[model samples]
Target: MEYVKGKPYFCYCDGKIKQYRYLDKDIKCEILIIGGGIDGAIANYYLSKDFNVVLVDKGRLGMSCTACATALLEYQLDDFAEDLLKHMTEGEIVLAYKMGIDAKGKINNFIKTQGNYCNFALRPTFLYTNSFFSIKSIKKEYEFRIKNGFNCKIFDSNNSPFTFPLKCGIYAENGGGEFNPYLFTKQMIENSKNQNSIFENTNIVQLIKNDHGYIAVANFGEKIYCEKVIIATGFNWEVLGIDDLCERFITYSIVTSPLKDFTWFNKALIHDVESPYHYLRTLPDGRIIYGGEDTIFKEKPINENVSNKKYDKLEKDLFRLFPEIEGETKIEYKFCGCFGSTPNNLGLIGESKIDDDILLFISCGANGIINAMAGVDVIKDILLRKNNPLIPLFSP
Candidate 1:
């Protein structure tokens, strides 16, 4: 569906995984995951430990939307607790926030044990705004965090430690993380228990229901008989043939060439309160990865003309934020990829509405990777027929 466009930074990074063979023969398993992006990698990594799982991708793994992900693993939702109250209760909001924190911990633990090949590191999170209209909302979010016992410091213009202008903001110490998304996807897939079952360039042409389960026919006529299926194709939902899965958007990003002595307070993950807001962080290589400026995705193959304009806007925005590097730094990478958002800022991570046997592991919103990391447990609990408090929050 041409879900991604332009040269993505992460895809060109080191630690790329070796290619997997296509489906040359029929296969069978307890659960069959139909995508090899980061979402599918997380699902397979966790679920395969308990269930018989197989993962297949139509193209190379982590080369699509996963490559373009900004990888800002913050525990904060796309919307504040105040705004999410319309769709979720106070308790649900708190739980979702906690889930985000726990998800970050999970990634940390994974890196600790699996080795930090993805350049994973925990960093502080800075949510700020220069607009006076946003101060109240940021304060409300800060108050919510305080009420929920999530330690964070609220900053105003007088107390701000950042170089950029800020009327108000919230700073949570080590409340977020950063990593190479493509490498992390590879890490998860290589560490997964079903390593031998992973396949690439195997497109499932059709899913035929059978007495036991369903038969997934590959493009080459090979078949996979599985009791359950997971569709983790990111924002590309054409495989489902069911539109309106979620509100889709094309989020743009630009990476700057390494600056010799450029940095912000604690090198924290910084995001603004502006609608279709912007985010920035320093890479391990001293470069800056900045993104946002999202536009609704009405169709695929992301328009180059629109993308080019967005890139221009993003470059200008970056310069506006850090005028010191305006003339010195040059943008090295420009890319845009599709992502989905739900009303609750949570992912569609449970059973499909059409059939319970068909699961959806699509992680939406800004904190998608975090959502997927924690939501995998919800999926596992469902597979085990156990109760999970997060089921209602992330369920499709």
Candidate 2:
């Protein structure tokens, strides 16, 4: 699928970080990772430290959905704890939330250890209700989070920072952050330069499993032999013929020019309880970035008219939330991309059901990057023949 439309803000701002040669000659490795986006980069970073790993992508690294991603690193799931209780046991819900918290901390530590080349910053997140009726659900969610040992606070309309109507909200602490995803992916790939090989513009056309390992054929018929394969192909995992486990949607976003005053946002990641909700955050450069307005994916072209309407709606929603910035902010960039969400809003990460030798990493839902990092940790443990208790939680 065409993951993104128009010029993504990350690519426009950072340009290409580093280029890799296409895979022309046959290669062999202990581990092979397909899809060099953020998930692939994370796998490479972790796997290369102990094993010989080779990463390949059909296009430039970090230029896929990773570039278009809002890169909000938070532990909050798109499915709240109270909602998940209907389907999952209390123990299961607690475990999932705890893993999410661990994922956030892992990402923060990884950014710090990697020298923070991605403008990583830890911040709080505010999830508010968009309507008066949503107040009850948000309150229950806040109480559930607190009861489960998560750091969260409840705020009513009287205490909310917004001038607009907000019935109530959950102010979650120590579990939210933002980062430049493109830069982070590039840096991770760069760090693996010595221990691993990375190939771009190389498409894996076929995968054949054998008694010993697997052979992945490239577009040019070049073969890659590896003991194991990791598919980090984001929303396009169906290329491997795996089951369509996620529902897809198209999401729109816009970035404004550096604002003189963004203190009203308090640099907190803001989202709401509404379906197809709007989310807003600020960049270190004082620019405002917001996304939402999702629609069912029908494979329609994002023509000029569609783009204009989506951008207009996003802008109108922004003004509704913060009217003070109506005339002060000028939108500098706008784009749309494909987003995927599972039924339970958790990622799919474990051994592929189609092939045991192929491990799949599909992080669907809002906390995608965080789930990707957590997947990396789980895959590493699997590689070392160690058991990760969180495996069953995200297993396919």
Candidate 3:
């Protein structure tokens, strides 16, 4: 069992979660899933192969925060040394890094087999820090990345293009990619349905540990029994009435033109070397979208005036590169969500203390697409009662 956030358990849905109309019936399966976001959907996809699976969500599959923005799928470690030093030892960082890389490979393989049209293309991801202090750490992480069998390079304006006033960056190749989040999530939904594994627009109201195993009751008083429950509810975990997750970190993001013809560079993904680091990549249609810069808190500031204001500033920043886009470019979408970050910026995985039969899987500081496969590995270890790469590190 793990320590849970000492706060009331409840999920608060934005307009998205509310729009879903779920079935009012009782269901039973070997694994009962809560939340239909990417993490939950993918978890169901893998777990259902051998187990009778049932998934419930407050909204449509992948329609929530998962489909709201462009997914920058990459395994590039952002501020790896700093993050590693704070939450884990160097050895642990190395292990986690390997796991991320392996997870990324697994996702790519799955996409290929499914013939998904999400534009899951591989490219290099670069991380830079405007601060001089990052130089040393960047060097350390770069070495660590390469030593662990990754294709990586270290950049200081002097070696590469000083095209800008950037200080230092670590560029890792073939470890990252970009995709159309909505389409990708949609494909997974189809796959799950074909397998007879997905329950769409189903709002799970409660979970109780019964002697048979676990019972999942939906909004219409419908109930289902299963051996275990997996919760990947994203920002709404607390909303599930789970007491262990109370400290939430909120973030905002927007999408723009894909990085197709970069009058800027040949690469599709890049980021500025600064705190609140910004990661940008091009979509299939050549639209480049950037995200990062989060302010931690209890609730989101959802107002057109406030959102547009931040968007305005971000637009101005983009103009500095393609001055022509000042008023030429228009926003295609806007999104905001809370991430459940652990003290170490790592995700919390494995069995939950609240119920021995429940497994709590969370995605916070890191990118989900790349981490999903690693998550599958954890779930497998839990089910098989065997040792997995991610179990020891993530188990509560």
Candidate 4:
């Protein structure tokens, strides 16, 4: 399935990662990770530290859905805390937020230790709404955060820091991050311990269970005999042959040509509270990535005609937020890709329902990269036969 379409800005960036060869023979290991996107790279990077691990992908790593990710690593869910109460406890919601903050810290530490080659930066997050109806909800969410001891401030039209109109908004001083997703994926995979065990263009076609474990057969008839499997193929689940994992959607994004001396309030990661809402962030080069306007996925490749319309809408919306840029800059890139979402706004990152030995690393929702950063520990705990409190929230 074609999960991404158009010229993704990340893939076209200057930094090119090292390539890996396809599997030519059978192999054996304690754990085999299928799908070499950012999620897989994260899992392999941490898991390989203790296990005999091998990571493989059907195609090149971080060039599919990962290529198009806006990568707003925020410590907030797509839904508000009150709405998530229907599917999760208040404690779980708080825990998820804490996990997101922790994950952001981990990413910072990794960059500090490994060198900052991914253009990563810590940024505040601003979630706002101009609608009167959304004001109450935004206030409630802010109250929840303050009650939980989160450091943030509430804004209204009287005290709004942004030029755009705002009825109400929540600002977290240390709530989010932004980065070059493809480069971050490259850094993780390259720094992983099992470099010799990583392969690209190596499709795993079947998994045959045996008394000891299972044998994963490749498209070219090669095999991977392993004790466990981790599927991190983003929204492409052809290998699992199952469709009920989560609700899938195609999200559209557009990037603008750099504007001279233009910047938002603190360059904070921004999200609006509209249905199928929009998000925006600033790149190091002054270009803005604006995205959203999602549609349900129906097991079809992205339609160019529909994508064109979506791009047009996104461009207009971008102007709506920042009218000064409408005549100054034009869109330089347009792209869309599939993403999954669960009711709880968490990911399927634990043992699969089909088989206990087969684990899943499908990081879903808007903060997927953040979820994956924290979720690796859940997978690690499961492999170590330890109890993880977050397991139930992300159980597959």
Candidate No. with top lDDT: 4
Q: Model 4 off-target regions past 4 Å?
A: none
Give the per-residue lDDT of model 4 (tens digit) for 1-396.
399899899888878769999999989999999999999999999999999999999989889999999999999999999999999999999999999999999999999999999999999999999999999999999999999988999989999989999899999999999999999999999999998999999998888998768899999999999999898988988788987799999999999998999998999999998987999999988899999999998857788898999999999888988898789999999999999999999999999989999999999999999999999999999999999889999997
Global lDDT scores for all candidate models:
0.92, 0.82, 0.64, 0.93
Q: lDDT at 113 for candidate 2? A: 77
Model 3, span 1-396: residue lDDT tens: 011111100111121222334655665688877878778877877777777887777666665566544466666544465566786777777777777777767768879899856667777777776678778877877777777667787778788653545678877766577666656655565566324546666667777778988777776777787888888876675435754473664345656633434444445477765666666665555555655665555443444354456566666666665665555556665555555556555566788877768887776554655566577778778888987767766765
Higher TM-score: candidate 1 or 2?
1
Using all chains and alpha carbons, the TM-scores for the candidates as numbered come to 0.99, 0.95, 0.87, 0.99
Rate residue 248 of model 4 by lDDT. Answer: 95
Report each candidate's C-alpha RMSD, comma-separated, in the order given: 0.9, 1.8, 5.7, 0.8
Q: Roughly what TM-score does model 3 have, to 2 decimal places?
A: 0.87
Clashes of each: 0, 0, 19, 0
Candidate ranking (lDDT, best to worst): 4, 1, 2, 3
Q: What is the per-residue lDDT of model 1 for residues 34-125, given as tens digits with 9 covering 90 to 100?
A: 99999999999999998999999999988889999999999899998998999999999999988999999999899989999998989999
Model 1: CA > 4 A from native: none
Steric clash pairs (candidate 2): none
